[model samples]
Target: MTAEIFATTPEGDTVEIVTLQNGPATARVMTWGATLQDFRLDGTPHSLVLGSPVFEPYRSRMRNYGAVVGRAANRIAGGRAPLNGATVQLETNEAGRTAIHGGSDGCGYVNWSLASHSETSATFTITLADGQAGYPGNLALTATYSLDDEGALTLEITGTTDAPTFCNIAHHSYWNLDGTPTLGGHTMHIDADSYLAVDEHKIPQGGPQPVAGTRFDFRQPRAITTPQDDPKLDHNFCLRLPGTEMHPACTLRAGDLQLEIDTTEPGLQVYDGSGLNSEVPGHGGVPYGPHGGVAIEPQKWPDAPNHPDYPQITLNPGETYRQVSRFHVTRI
Candidate 1:
């Protein structure tokens, strides 16, 4: 359990990587944006290491932009929120009118206060003022990360709001199990039978649809980039089952290492890292071109607040909001 002040860039900024070696598992954590730079499971490497120049093309303008996403983790259709019967407007960062992950200076960009840090764990907290990002209430959000003896990396996100508001948070990690040049060889298996289809704007269209014969089906283990559509999986899956109780969400294997992603979130957004602009740079001096890694983002459905048919994300005063997503890796 030792954290290192890794090499710095010409930006005159210091990037710290937290390392934790527990039994057969090792993790490298970065503070540039509070991201998981690398994780080796049972001697098999995962996570796309960060290089000198970090490039985020697809999400380039803001790829791995924030250490943690906030206020709302996903998109907010029309950038509107209904709190206490009052509609509040939010910042829209996308090209069109739709709001994607809060805006440029949204939660993802804010430098969170490091509440606590240790060899095997770290905790970060940030307080959101009322009307921050055009949302409803003042929010106090906290995220904690811990690695257990079983080699499971558990992320716990808890939030409390003084007023009615929608709060969602998550850890955006790009996992490449083979520790190779890319994530093409990594295989995936998702325990989902349907998904939320979206329109051109990438907004949820209707309700859940079956994945029995569709390309979105991941019930069987298959290469993450099997089809020519590597780095093209930008969709939300309607998990077969939803609950607060922990369950197997998805399993990924790279080379001889295997990872089981478990979460209590209702939906999982699979963004194949298709859009990494050259500006963000890459890890280990390698280029983060399309499909450099895969982001299995588990959380409430995107734009859940706008869809009445979808699950609601409203949290009022006195209601404790909690979410847990874990990546447990082991040797095959």
Candidate 2:
């Protein structure tokens, strides 16, 4: 593991950037938000993801660019949910009425502690106090990023709570295979028969709806900006359940670069960078605009607390939470 001082927090805390290398792939991870600062392959001239060159933009501008999001990965309606047969009010950070991504006090903004590091892997840990984000229990979470010689990067997140709480951790990385100005030409294919429908505020309507005959269908590879593509997409695509084994969830291709996203989670949220308009220049001094990249977040179904039919997101006192996801890039 190679480390360097990345930046210092406003509170006078030190933050570092750790780099893990394996064969042709190199990943630079920052302690702030446990975020992926840069990912590059040996022969590639451009970085694989959209990210700022400094820490300030990550905190002030970039929506969740390559951060470890949690407590709850998605929204909870009315800023409240049921816990132990009672209502638990949550901190509202989205439009002042809903709790999105653990209410802005989420793990994405916290500086995680470096748990351990080696040549090819690094682990970062964060502790979420009970009721810190309006959730119960004290949650101890660890996010580990590992890269193999075969050019596959795996992110494994594990958590354990001291009391009953809601925990759904997901990696939020905006990927741009070629690091181009726009991802409109990128081809994408998601392995999902149905996707959760969302309302105007991007909240899940009720349950999963069939993707057939709809723009959500990605059973086959298609250009991301085709007529079938929606102007803005923040919906969660429902995958096969049980989630005991990792499987190929989606594939994104841009020219000669291809990225295969696989995960053990049953849901994948696809964001096409529609709302990205950043003043801070990304790596290589490129200003990221709308559709600058695409985010493929793998985790539990959104708003699971209110919908009993969806998969559960609860973590009991003695239970452990685990999610495994991989991003494998190759030249086509």
How does model 2 fare in lDDT?
0.88
Question: Which candidate number maximizes TM-score?
Answer: 2
Report the lDDT tens digits of candidate 1 across residue range 1-332: 77666645455545556677666677765554455656765644334333333322313344553245666877777787665677778877776576666566555654455566787887767777887767778888877778888878888889898888887776677776666756778888998998988877788888999978777889999877665552257888877665548777899887777779898888888877667543544544455666776778878888887777887788899998898988887777
Give, for candidate 1, the lowest lDDT window spanning 10 residues.
50-59
Per-residue lDDT value at 253 in model 2 = 96
Q: Estimate TM-scores for all models.
A: 0.87, 0.97
lDDT of 2 by residue, 1-332 (tens): 79888999788878888999998899999888889999998899989988887888887888588999989998888878898999999998888988888867799988899888888999999999998878988999999999998878999999999999999988999999876799866999998999999877777888889989887888898777655556467789998554459887999999788899889999999987888888789996968998898989999988889889989999998899999999999988
Cα misplacement distance, residue 240 of candidate 2 (Å): 2.7
Candidate-wise lDDT, in order: 0.71, 0.88
